[model samples]
Target: MEYQYCETDPFKRPTHLLEANPRGMVPAIREGDWASGESAVILEYLEDRDRDATHKVPLLPTDPRLKANCRLWIDHINAKIVPSYFNLLRATDRTNQSEGIDRLQIEIRALVQAADERGPYFLGADVCLVDIHFAPFVLRLPRMLSQHRHWSDPIPGTRWHMWIEALERNPHIMATTSSSELYLETFDLFMNSRLANGES
Candidate 1:
């Protein structure tokens, strides 16, 4: 199987394999004429292919509760943590900073607890799609955290520190993704523009 990863922001890239599937995003994968889009959907489809497929970590678990817990954490991170990070990025004035930081701290605390609830990994020793779903964002978190003075303490105090450790130690995780320096450059430009424009 061949995977085509579009690394640009979807708005910047415009056209993607998602045009074929209409899932409102990239990170699309094509197998012959078949295509799938949207990170979550593409990940699920790929996971279904085989138990041993390496594109993603295994998702199925022997215990139904563990599976449910994995899915629950995935959803919680997407709904809570992701948005709070964006809020932090887009924060402009002091008010934005205050509210964004508050939300971010709460979400980060919850995420840390959820992540620690299992052990070594989101699902213990072996990683899973839950880990993958959050990997891209987590991989970028350190750089993002560096941009904010407020994040310095929370990052290491929370599961975010563990995330950095995992991603760095695991060669298979986002090994094909761009260098940290590039992400830093673009993120700085993005934050600078957002700050200057009073965007939130």
Candidate 2:
């Protein structure tokens, strides 16, 4: 399938992408008139298409309990950690940034506690949906937090560190990632634009 990358600002999307998925979000996929928005929805669509697992890796496990558990954690990440990351970004002032950092750390600590005790990945040695859901925010948010808020790593030398190291070594994560320099530049620009607009 052909890929089109564009500005992630939903209100400012290019017409083609806006047509492909009316939500105007990045990570939308379309084929002709058919399209899907949201990463979780897209992942479920892909999983359903390959239900027999004859082609492509099965991201959700075959076991019913394991699959449900992964879904639970994905929801937690979506509901908790993800919102805190956005809050942290919008928090340009020192007091708000501190609140953002505390909020994120609390959410993250809960996630770590819920994760498999034996894991570098959420589900023991294998990468799963929980890991996938956490990956984008986990990779992008911390750098912004550190650069803009003087945030140091929270829960260092613990499972957080192990989990991050495991994700870093995963081929898919490594391959899909942009350089740290570019990541910083893009995030800084977004933050600055928000600040200019007096967005909280």
The C-alpha RMSD of each candidate to the native structure, in angstroms, is: 3.7, 2.6
lDDT of 2: 0.79
- TM-score quality measure for candidate 1: 0.77
Candidate with maximal lDDT: 2
Best by TM-score: 2
Tens-place lDDT digits, model 1, residues 1-200: 45554565543445554554565455676677887666677777777776675654466565889888878878887898788888777776768877887887787667666775544467667777777777776666666665663555334534556655776577767566578787877677777666677764
Off by over 4 Å in 2: 1-11, 53-57, 154-157, 192-200
lDDT of 2 by residue, 60-154 (tens): 98899988988988999999999998888778778998999899889988988988888888988888888988988778766666777776764
Q: Supply candidate 1's per-residue lDDT for 109.
A: 69
- Which lDDT value does model 2 have at 126? 81
